[model samples]
Target: MKKIVTLLCLGILLVNCSNNDDEMDIENSTEIVVDETQEMGTDMYVGNFVSLAHPTSGVVSVSDDMSRLDFKNFKTDNGPKLLVYLTTDTDATEYVNLGDLKGIEGDYNYTIPDGTDIGKYKLVNIWCVDFSVSFGYAELKK
Candidate 1:
């Protein structure tokens, strides 16, 4: 019985170790290199992030004067290298790369660069830059 238990423990350890590597890779890759040099304002346009892989729900707000965008009460999978984008669609060539996401879960702010034409982009996308996957998105409306 002792030997059997020992073997089982070893087996579990190995399995856990293998899974950790993948998760670690994702964790490491998702860490955004932040500049942290801007001030964000109040909400202008807003929407909620509907889930793609996991359930995501929150208010995504673009500043009233178009100075910044924010994710409030946000939650989603901690994917590798998540990024923020302003685009017409998930796969659009013409897009504004907001920046690397501040985080996957919680309230965060992203400063919108000046002169970004808001006429065409209507979607805020949470994308995994490492995996080329969209974790979730928010659609802006009038």
Candidate 2:
């Protein structure tokens, strides 16, 4: 009986160790792959904002598809009611309102309305609606 019990214990230990080895082999044989085919859109138009009624400075860019606007290192004076616009001229006479200005400082993004003519409207204007004044402007260029 003692001899039979000792043999059974050894057999169980060996089986457990063999299963561990199989698990380790599976882990080592597993493969990993990475794909790097896709790329981000490049800027189609870029301009520097110039202060008009208030102090403003930043870089504005439009993506290649003309679907979005990006503001980098943006800085401006705070106002009561400020708005952003894309216009044909600096005066903001004929324009499409993007939205309210996001902040007086830092980076921002505004979506351009689909089917809007970007080539015709080349100026990005920061205008105050409450006082009806232009805080700054940037002329987009290719």
Candidate 3:
């Protein structure tokens, strides 16, 4: 009976699973949005990355205009199917996919979708989409 119930629950979850892309109303543009400064923005909200499933270190900042995510001194272990996400929590519930990570180590930028409510997201996750795990995350703050 226990095994049957577990399988039933798993099946229900599978049926409800949907691709995150469909939930997002973002543009498909790949253009980098960082301004001439090429550095953190003046009125940015920032956070420091913490290792979770892998060794990760960096600083993540959201531009004051909420137009971009800037990763500075960012370092993380390379993994297959890694993605960047702005999530409501470290667990990635209620989030927006920024897209595939640009590199495993470097300063880079990811453009945020126009009209996204940046205030709703609390953490930036280095997520491994294939494995359903977070390699690291940064909790954002003013």
lDDT of 1 by residue, 70-133 (tens): 7878988777787889988866455789888887678888888898866678788887777777
Candidate 3 stretches greater than 4 Å from native: 1-39
Q: Estimate, for each residue in 43-117, the C-alpha lDDT of model 2 and write its tens digit.
A: 888899999999999989898888899998899999988999999987888999999999989889999999878
Question: If both were scored by lDDT, which would come out higher, candidate 1 or candidate 3?
Answer: 3
lDDT of 3 by residue, 95-139 (tens): 899999999998999999998777788789999988889999998
The per-model lDDT (C-alpha) reads 0.74, 0.85, 0.84
TM-score each candidate.
Answer: 0.65, 0.70, 0.70
Model 3 steric clash pairs = none
Cα misplacement distance, residue 51 of candidate 2 (Å): 0.6
What value does the lDDT take at residue 42 in candidate 1? 39
Query: Which scores greater on lDDT, model 2 or model 3?
Result: 2
**What is the overall TM-score of model 2 with all chains considered together?**
0.70
Candidate 2 — what's its lDDT?
0.85
